[model samples]
Target: MSHNINGKAAGKFAAVEQEFAKNFAERGEVGASVCVSVGGETVVDLWGGTADPATETPWERDTVSIVFSCTKAATALCAHILVDCGLLKLHAPVSEYWPEFAKNGKELTTVQMMLNHESAIPAQREPIRPGGFLDWDYMIQRMEDEEAFWEPGTRNGYHMVNFGWTVGELVRRVSGKSLGTFFRDEVASLLSAEFWIGIPDDFSQPIAPIIPFVPDPKMELSPFTKKLLTEPQSIQALSFLNNGGWTPNDPEAHKAEIGGAGGIANARGQVAMYEPLANGGSINGVTLVSAARLAEMGKVSTATQIDATLLAPTRFASGFMKSMDNRAYPGGDQMSAVLGEAAFGHVGAGGSIGFADPDHDLAFSYTMNKMGAGLLLNDRGQSLIDATYAALRA
Candidate 1:
C-alpha cells in the first residue's frame, strides 16, 4: 500500500491532505484526486494511487476519468450562459424552440421544468441502441416520440441519462452549437481547464479506465438497493442502462457527447470549471453570466420533492442540485452532501463529485478511477470535505 501522494496543501488545509491520503491506505481508493478552491484560489490539489490497476500505471498529475453525472453541471452551465445572454427564457415552453417536442402532451414543458427534472421524460419508451448515444439526431428523435412517465412539470424524478439530451438539444437550437462545442469554447477554453463533454477524436490525454468495485459476497443490500437491483424494467434501472450501459473502457464513448454521464475530467479540471460559480459567475475577467442572472439562476425554483427514479428527496435550482434540507437518502439513511445550503453542483456515479460552496467561497472536485456503490457522496470524498471545512473553521 506504499504509494506516493502528489500535490501540495496550504498550511491551513493540511488536515485535508491527511484525509485524502487516509482514503488510499484505510479506505479502498485505487486512484483519485481532490482539488479545492477558496475565493477562486486553489488551496488544495492532490492526486495519488494507481491510474490503471491492471497495468499498475502510476497516476500522473494529468490523469482524468469519466466523472459520470458531474457532467450535468457543465450542461446546466451552458443553459445558464444562454439565459444570461437573454437568448433563452426559463419559462418558455420547449416547443417554442423545437416544435416536434410539443406533441404527446408536452406542449407545456418549459426549459425550467427540464432543468429541474420535472419534465417527467425520465426513461426511454424503448431502450436506445447500444451505439445510439453517439447519434444525436437519433436520440433526440427518440425523445420527441417517447411518452412522459408522468405529467410534465407535475412531479420530480431523476432524469438520469435523459437530462443531457433534454438540455443539450435546447442549447443546440438556441446557441447553434453542440453542447460539447459550446462548453469547450465558452467554459473550458476560457478557464484553461481540461474538461470534455465528448472526448474529441484528435484530443489525446491520459485517462484511467474505471475499475468497478466488488463488494464482499456476504454483504446484504438494503431493501431499497435490492429493489433497484432486481427491477430491470423499472424506470430506476432504465435510467442508467438504456444508452449502451456506459463504461470508461469504451474508446468510442469518448467521442460522443452524452452530457448527463459522459464528462471526462481530472479533479483540477472540475475545480476550475466550478470556480466561476464560486466567484460570482466569472473567473479571470472572463464573464459568462451577469450578477443579476447568476442570482436568478442559482435560486431554488423546484419544490423539495422525492425523486421517483432515485427514491431520494432532492432539490434543484436551475440545473444544479441544491443542498437538500432533508435527507437525500432512502428513509433519511444518509446525507447527500457535506457542503452548505448555498452549495450547488452534482455528483457523478461511482463517487466522483464537483460543487461550488458559495457560502464559504469554495469550489471542490474529486475524481477517481475506482467505482464505489452509492447514490451520493461516498465516505472517501466526504472525509476530504469534512477535513477541509474543519481546517477552515479551526
Candidate 2:
C-alpha cells in the first residue's frame, strides 16, 4: 500500500524518493517515512509502506510512530529553550532547580551531566508499573533516592530510560509545567509539528505499535555488560525494556509520559519539530530559542571513547551523537563525508533517527515501526541517510 507524497517542494528530493521505494521493496520495512528540510524549506516529505504488521492499512501521511530515544533530542530542545530564557542554566548544578536531585552525591551534577549521560542516574530502586510513568513525583523521588552506578561526571553511559525524568523534572520545577506540556505549547504548536513527549489523546488511533526484534542467541553482551547491569542504576536502565518499559503488550502504555524515551511522531512531524534548530532556533517566523543557545548545543561536551557501561567506543555531544572521522553514524563512513562536526540529534533503540545538521541547514528525520536486528543505526535508516547525502551532492 503506497501513500501519496503531499506538500510543496517535493520534486527536489528525487534521490530520497528513489531510496524510499528501494527500502520498501528490498529492506522489509513495514511502515516508515523520511523527511528533509533545508534552509527552512521542506525538500523531501515522503511516506509509504504498510502501517500494521498484518498489512491491513496503508501508512498514511499523518500516521505517527514511536521514535523511542529520538524523543531525547526534542527533550533536549525543551531544556535549551529554558536555558535561553534564563529560566535554567546549562552549567549550574541541577540541584538548584530540583533540590531532591542533590541526593546520592549528585549535588554537584549539572544540566550538562544529565544531557551528556554522565549523571550516573539511570533508574530507580523501585520498579515502576508500565502505566505508572505518568506520575512525575513518584518517578523523580525514585531517582532521588537511588544511588549512582558510577561517580557523576567520571564517565559516559547511556542514561537509557531515566534521562527524560531527570531533565523533565528540572523543566517542570523551573517552568511550573511538565516537559510534555512545555514542548506542546512552546515547540510543537509553534512549528505546527505533531511530535509529542507524552502522546495526546486524539492521535492515539494513528500510532503504529512498536515491534521488538527477536534476540539473537549468538550475540551476547560481554562480561563487562553483565557487571554493568548488576549495579542498581544499571538495572533501572535495563528495566525500560522489561514488562515495564515501552513494550507494546500494554495498550495504555503508549499514553505514559516518559520524556526521554516515549516520544511519538511521523517523519515529517519529527523533521518539522527540529527545523528551527537547523535554522538557528527559528523556522519561518517562529523562534524557539536564540542562535547563541543553538550554538551551545552543537559544541562537544563528550567525545569518542569507550563508553563506561556499554563498553564500546561511541562519539557523543551534549545529548547528540557525533560523527567521527574513522567511523560515522551506523553507515555514514562510506557515504558523503560532508557531515559537519556540529551535527546534533538522537537515535532510537531499533533503527529510528532524527537530527539537525546546521552545516547543511538541514533537519532530517526517519522513523519505522519494524524493529531491526542491530544495536547501532539499522540498515534501512543508514541507506536512506546515505542516499539523501548522495542526492544533495548531485
lDDT of 2 by residue, 18-96 (tens): 7777777887677888898889888888787777766567678788888888888888888888889999888899888
TM-score of each: 0.95, 0.88
Q: How accurate is candidate 2 locally (lDDT)?
A: 0.74
Q: Count the backbone clashes (under 3 Å) in each candidate.
A: 0, 0
Identify the candidate with maximal TM-score.
1
Give RMSD to native, each candidate: 1.8, 3.6
Tell me the tens digit of each residue's lDDT in model 1 across 39-155. Answer: 988899999999887788988899999998999999999999998888999999998888888777777899999999988888886868878887888889988998888888888
Residue 119 displacement (Å), model 1: 1.0
Worst 10 residues of 2 by lDDT: 329-338
Question: Relative to the true structure, how large is the alpha-carbon lDDT of every model?
Answer: 0.84, 0.74
Candidate 2, residue 51: how far the Cα is off, in Å: 0.8
